[model samples]
Target: MIEQEQVLDALRAVYDPEIPINVVDLGLIYGVEITADGDVTVRMTMTAPQCPMSGYLLQQAEQGVRTVAGVRNVKVDLVFDPPWEPSMIKEDALKSAGILTDTPANPVEGDCSTEK
Candidate 1:
């Protein structure tokens, strides 16, 4: 059986062309499911709705995961239900990328919170 960690490791090999960070670190990967039959399904989203490199990114993700041992098939599903935001990026990655800010780069409108 293939482990989720292996799948994630493979994902770390793939990256968004626009950004230097990998998909996992960027928080583009939402969830990962591995079937008993060794099939892997990854739910992910793009940084933007109209990203020109979205297709290329998806193909890279699928191909990357497919290379993992014991993975019979790989499926990457693009979703936008919850949307992607800078706040979703891992804290460590944010600090490493030097993009960590006091507030989100794309904060929601009318969002007000004073809990610092």
Candidate 2:
């Protein structure tokens, strides 16, 4: 029987082209289910539904999971009910990217137009 943890590790191999963190750590992976027959089901979502790379990301996730030793089939189901936010990023993942783990009190907003 294929271990669920191994399958999750495989799924974590997929990375968003724009993000430094892998999808799993990015909180995009909502759920993973493995069946007795080796079929796997993955429910996931992107940072934004309008993201142009959504199709590519989904395909990569599916392909990545299939590479697991005993995974016979992979089904990726995308959802956006709760919506994605930067706060969803795991603390470890944020730390790996060198992002401050502490919540910024009174976050600052800079106007990019002034730089020009």
Worst 10 residues of 1 by lDDT: 107-116
Model 1: runs farther than 4 Å from truth?
Answer: 101-116
Score candidate 2 by lDDT.
0.88
Error at 11, model 1, angstroms: 0.2
Clashing pairs in 2: none
Per-residue alpha-carbon lDDT of model 2 for 71-107, expressed as tens digits? 8889999999789899999999888887755655553
The sequence of per-residue lDDT tens digits that candidate 1 reaches over residues 48-79 is 99999999999999999999999998899999
TM-score of 1: 0.82
Q: Residue 50 in candidate 1 has what lDDT?
A: 96
How far off is residue 52 in model 2, in Å? 1.0
| lDDT of candidates 1 onward, in order | 0.91, 0.88
Which candidate gets the maximum lDDT versus the true structure? 1
lDDT of 1 at 82: 90
